[model samples]
Target: MAVVVGVLAVAGALVAVTGPAVLRWWRPRPASADLIHGPGMWAALRPVLGVAETERRRTWLHLPVTVGEAGARIVLRLPAGWASGEAGTRAVDAIVTGRLPGEWAAHWCRTVAAPYVEWVRNAAPDRPRELPKSVEWMQTGDPLKIHFGETPEGPAFVHTGTATPHIGVSGETGSGKSSILYIPLVAARLAGWLVTVIDPKQNSLTEADEKSGIRIHSETYECVMAIAEFFVSMMAAEKYNGRKYRGHSGPDSPVGRLLVIDELPSFREYVAAWWKYIIRERGFPPVLVWFQLILMQGRSSNHRVLVGTHQFSLDVFGSTMARDQVGTKMVVGEVSIPSWTVAYGAGAPMVDYDETIPGRGVISLKGRRRKKTLADGRIERAEEIQYAYITPQVSDLLDACPPAPAWWDAGAMAPWITPRDLARADSAAAVKDFLPGGRFAGGREDLTPDTDTDVQLTQGSMPRSEAMSDVSGPGAVSGVGEGLAVADLVEKVGAEGIEEQRYTIAQACAVGIIRKKPGAARQYKSAWIKEGKPFPEGEMIRGNASYTREELESVFGTPEEDADSI
Candidate 1:
């Protein structure tokens, strides 16, 4: 019996030593499915929870696990010490890694009132390319509903009138900035909003403009004028917002205005002069001032601005108020870290800047009453979305609405003058002195004659030969400075002759025959003198001036009467 007891005791001790090890080796390793759910998850989590046994009860409340096609998400809530900072976050991360499968990703978020740990697993499958629906089908009564594109989760949209009135789009070249613009323009048109596109490069939005009939302004001057006109319209809307008109979108309500400015850097470069003036005068550029007005008052007046730029700087926008007022911000493919911050703020997603996927962007919308829940169960204000591809048919849908007219053409509030007009006016005035009848052509009539013979020639009617001799003599020297006025020339030529030639003072001025003088303000002079012509001694009156025969013959070729006499 003692031998039997000794053998049993030895067996019991060996069993205690090897049983746990043998059971562990025999047990199944945690598969993906096991870690996702069932009793396997709790069994796996128990040991990880034990690592923080002192704080486990306070830190971890419950684990909510959800599995989807994209991946599996496990949310851990910390009810008591949720506000515990980075230390608590690190501790949770440790527990998650210790407990979950090796492939899972842990993202910690501090909510408004509490903190939660989100653990994600599995790679997201490739999302199929989603083409935009027809504009007619996408139209909704809600002015705020702007359909952006589809994501793996679902379709994405932004609220304009009710939430925010501006959108900022930032991307590298070929990063699908045009796609984002095209989609919004279509949406705005379908919604009955008048659309204006300011494209400095002209190529970026030209296709859409031609295909859809959206009004496009490519010239810097045209764009500046258009914005000014639009600002006036916006002011009118603002004044009538509550009194003369209702501020909602409908057939009876006042129409809304949507302005899309593309290639903002190019536009800025083109308008650098305006910027310089603004800085020198310590005033805002008129466009930016009006843009700010639209932003501040547009929500009620139904005016909105959407700007796209490759340059991602607040200074590029000119005003911090304007930059900060943008309600929707999108950053696409390969932007610098600073650009990312400017687009989506400091806590933006950690995106791979080298990623070359066009249309893939981080979109953040402000003033959203409802936030979307990510796979990890954290509410997300910003989402990773792929904008819809704009197809030819979609562009064709824009044809249904007639293109909005250039903003300046919509009103007569202010006279619009182009640089070309100013240049032409200046050129016409510059060569006035060198023309036929210029300001310097006429001499002063009050100057005294140089000789008594000149006085006799002026006062007496001598024989035609004697008169001719007197005109050619030194006594007629005073007549060289005293040139005939246009009125005096017409009178001497006879009204019939003047009419036959179809000549008038206005016509003479237009054809460079005469110019206004600085000495007499409204007086003019004849720069041209008929060559070989005897001076018109008969037309020389007290208030009128006459040229000497020699002076007349020098510049204007032989006179009709003088040639007849010869």
Candidate 2:
């Protein structure tokens, strides 16, 4: 009897130790079958799916249901004789019409190896409205990431790369295009890219330029000049790299270049003149030619373009070649069905155009597939996404970039002249004389009636060579001629001397030693004496400004003496 009592005590201890876990495992809060394949759902779906009783018993197969915290998913396989397409479509229609007992929705119905229909019953709620805390930059060889919107899986990101070089962004005026554009710009800047913006509207990217130090070209001429320079430089770099541009962050390779044209339609209007000059007169292709070139060859060179417009249409893109080159398409706000069809092509998922949200949109990466190990990976297609807003920290991060060259105003050619005229002038040495410092000279060239004349004068009645030469001569201190170019002034003073004094043109202007001329180009004026003298702090003068060599010496000190001090 004592032995039997000890055995019973041991059994009791085991039971006490395992009872709670066993009960917890067995207890069911909910079952996927009860939520998904319950009698009510089957009864509601049978007639709608057009499955006769005999056919349902013979062909319809119910796979295992997946239950999550919010809802469950039911997958149904159809037999060989049954038409999966008609059945899947009908089932989705019924589910959307509220035929089920609970709220039901057809997530997706795909026909892969086997024909199957998947339905969700309260599977999940809409993604929460939250913005990214910070912007993340993509690494070299990594895909470009744009935080678009939220999805059931999590925050949705639209990625692009060499295979998907260009992106087409379309939305209405206030439909968060700025938010979409800002995300990528900040990301690119953070990654140490050179971002060139052509914002015809001007207002679209003002905040980014002001806070992020992004270069925004608002004027038509400015855009043209910026694009021209970018194309020339990229072409030069490509040629230098043996016609094959390798995208690596090095002194020779440099960082990537991202050209963003906000409102392409408006920009196109302004580019008509430039197009005529470059294409008709110069025998080169239109501006779109460069765009096409970049689209085709730029991928390898880490050069990309993003064009934003209010409408996504073939006509807006000017040609099918240009439109088809864009590999990624993003549409936001309320878009018409026709527009959607144009943006995404056929086989696009049905979108509820009536249910419009500000930042909500669909994005598709063409010819891209998710990397999956088993079976063929799913193709990257259009899906809903929410874009992130620019935060204060992101703005600060952008602001930290070093100041870029004033390229917009520095290298622009006169808008009035044709490309042929400019070429001829250049060959005649007229162009070189007009722009002596290899930068923009705002003053127009005074072409004599005789076309054969090589010497071109400015409106101010001074020959270009004479003015440049005068600045380089000894009498420059006494102001022998018109104002000298800043490049000439730097050369005269010697760059090393100027560096020792730590002086800049802006500083000189602030100190009342130099004056800035008003025009499309940047020019400075000053009057110098043989001896150094100080000017009044608050003095302000404006006219045909000329700066004497003595003024430069007074502000920057003698080049030799300054070098010695250094």
Candidate 3:
């Protein structure tokens, strides 16, 4: 009996020692969405969360994760002094990021829920997404719904207006910033909304104006005046909130009125210089005040801003409020973590920025309201995708946008611009060259290319005539302080044969002389070129031959009433 008892005791000791280990090893790991329950997550997070007993409770015991069709959101119970600060965020960021088990992380995309407060993640793409036609998205039948890029399911769209407003595009110098900027510019242009590009660099903006019919303000004073004019429009609307209204998002852009600031740094520099001049004369910082107002109040009045920049920071905006108000944040290519933070807010997605991919970047839209009570409200990518289209299609879309009704001229958008004339500057040289038929460059005398509203507002109060006069000589220069653009013959033509300038047909089309399409202009130009008449071989605007403003004028002769139309 004693021998039997001894054997039994030995067997019991071995079982006690090996039983828990066997059970732990035998425990079935979560195969799929079951990992969202957090029971199996501790093993993956142990290195970051620690091996302490308290850590296990803080994670699996208290962590609450819910999964849905769109994504999974993770919430945590806060301990004493343990808020969304650095230490807590670092621990949680690991929880929602790629740090999760490969199978689990691959199941969902990671983005912040409230930036260090709570974190939510979106589902990963199941298959490769194909590039879509830019024109198809344009025909979505909704003016406010714009197709920004592509996703796994198909074209990824961002909605403008009340629920989600404003957009921000950031990238390195060569990372497709211009292409992404063109997305909204084309959408707003096609919709026949007033599109304004406040390009401080002034690079190709004149061409952009000629092609897209967007308002351009490159100089500091002109930009400030443009902002002020938009603010005036905001005031004309019914007020609810207290905010000035230059229109938020220079790349802003409301649905009807868009203000695109291609370079935030240059724009701020321009504003600062103007501030010094205005403070000396007007005793107040009048420039960015209007901008801040729009950033705050313009949403209710349907005025929004879209900003595009190579650099980003709260310092880029006049107030922290404006940065907070930016609802749509998109970052393309490889950018620093801090820049991603400023662009997408704190605890933004930890996305890999691939520079080789054309327009490869992450985008997040704010105001992600729930569709149903149980539905996920996070409406953005957890991973990066190509968010831009090819540049070749812009000119065709520009032409297809079509002209506004003939009766709408006098009642055209406050700037007196029509749909067909959308891409042309009001002071078109083509109009000046035409004979008596239609009023060429209608109201161009009232609003010059340099200034928008009365310059009296720019420098306290000056005479209307002086405000309207050409102030191009001295202190009028903005950031660069020197003219980089050669004197355009388009501007020089029309007056006493304007220094005898020659132009290609494409140049003439660009300056609003002929249609941007290839049909008639190409045939006419080829006929002239075949005769070998020393026709200064022209450049191609859209895979078709072009002529200078003078040549197009000589060949096309302003098309009667269509003289000012591009």
Candidate 4:
């Protein structure tokens, strides 16, 4: 027992000490001593210049750059044939300049000093430029491409088109999936190809611009019928009066048509029905498919689908349809996913199921040709996938699209009101005139004069004689800040009884209209009362919590626009 305990104690001690040491060693390192190239410059060339030990062209390095008073610098223990000749000089210049493209040019400059200099600028075949607006197509790397196992491992990874791209996107709810999806839509639309999108969550598809030639609909029977109609349209465009597929002419040419549906499982029972409708009734060939989960259960052998999910099902590869049809499978988050390649006969590597990797993913790539003389003169096995950052680009075009029309404003809830409604509707004072005393019996009625109105108010603008309820107990406003407490704000707006007020505030915060200060409570202060005496526009009154004017402006914008923006 003592010997066993000693062994156990040794094991625990090893885990406590060595485990952290190993982790610390593997952790992403900060830029230390200078590299011949800066990080941005290194990133640009990573795809071209394959790493030394790895058989593939994707170069994985742990060089984190910190921008400081002295500018940005990256430290790396460069390999042989690196840091030689004019390219080396250019790399130094690029680091000093702190510009990417300039660094890229310098890193790839002609170098007679190194025989392998030509290999440093190796360009991967360019993939189709048509990708979503939100997804910026940064340079490709073997680690990124082979990370999926769709493509073979090699120095040739960049410019490989989205013909087969494995994307990994991570964001919380309400963090803008619509914005992310828009990029591929733009790409497909520009390429004169059709994009079929399935958004089961339903939030992202609403309010997308119609002019962009996308067909957005809910996951309903009617929506399925519309999808059938779209299939028919594609069939007609391709068939050419029963000639052949992929052959089209006239105004009905299959140029650009994307069918987007949100909330897929809502119509899960209708999937087989829609398939029959498309194949038997409509007869459409698939161009591109975006499945944000839901319809991923079933697959078709002909079309390509981009399956996005927080958790990927291993069952995906079990189907021949998924293996044969789905070219690119993109797992979005660092969540646990079932191995798809094992079922599909593809040797895709299992991703490290580390839930704490932030926004990393492992994709199983297939179909690319492998090389013979790479890893120790042995051919690297297939199922190689690469890691690439799916960084979102903030575009004003997304904001231009109108917010989805709410259910509250629907026909059943209320009659549609345009700007003309405000001009034509009778004032609240008009309605109050007919009421006896303009006050309820048990309620407090202060007969304050209408003369104490702000410039915007008038005698006739008193919405009604105050319908004030009785003041009960010590009702005090909670917390402190430049804006009213959520409850108090609702009460001040006379929406105390309305359930939608809280939701309204939440939505406003979601879309960057109002700033929701977390950790500390805040309060409301009116600029009207203070008359500009070091006025803190919107003060977050939590003790020891303060922000500079520059920070506030950057986050919530000028205080005047906050309410309206929300």
Best by TM-score: 3
lDDT by residue for model 1 (470-507), tens: 22321222122221223344455545543323222222
lDDT of 2 at 135: 32
**Model 3 lDDT tens row, 1-566:** 99999999998988887776675756555444445546555555444433455565444333333354444545543343333446745655556554443233322222444222344455564665544423233446565777877655455677886544788888877787877777776777677766657887767333355343455755555555555555555544433233664434432232366778888877887666655664234444454666666778777766678888775587777666776567677888787878865665454457654557676777774333332221223234344556756466676676566443322222223432232332232132122111111121111222223321212224323433343233233212211111111124345666584554543442343345565322235445535654665554555533334355555655556656464554
In terms of TM-score, which candidate is stronger, 2 or 4? 2
Model 1 regions lying over 4 Å from their true place:
1-142, 210-213, 244-253, 274-284, 352-354, 366-380, 402-566
- Please give, for residues 1-566, the per-residue lDDT of candidate 4 as tens digits: 99999999999989888886576866655544225334455555454444543432223332334333232333333354654556754554444345322121213324444223211212335552322112124322221232211222332132113433323222234433343445444434344444445543444544442322333333332233333333333333333334463344443233434444332223343444433442222332121131321123221211223334332233322333333333344433343323333322333344443334332333333334553233223222223223332324213333333332222111111112222332232131121221112321111121111111111111221223322211222231111111123334444445455432322222233223345422111112112222333533333332222334443444446556665676
Instruction: State model 1's lDDT.
Output: 0.52
Q: Estimate the overall C-alpha local distance difference test score of candidate 4.
A: 0.32
Candidate 2 lDDT over 212-273, as tens digits, reads: 22456664434544555445434444443453543433334434678888998878865664
TM value for model 4: 0.32
TM-score of each: 0.49, 0.51, 0.51, 0.32
Please report how far candidate 1 places residue 11 from its true position, in Å. Answer: 19
Residue-pair clashes per candidate = 8, 10, 32, 40
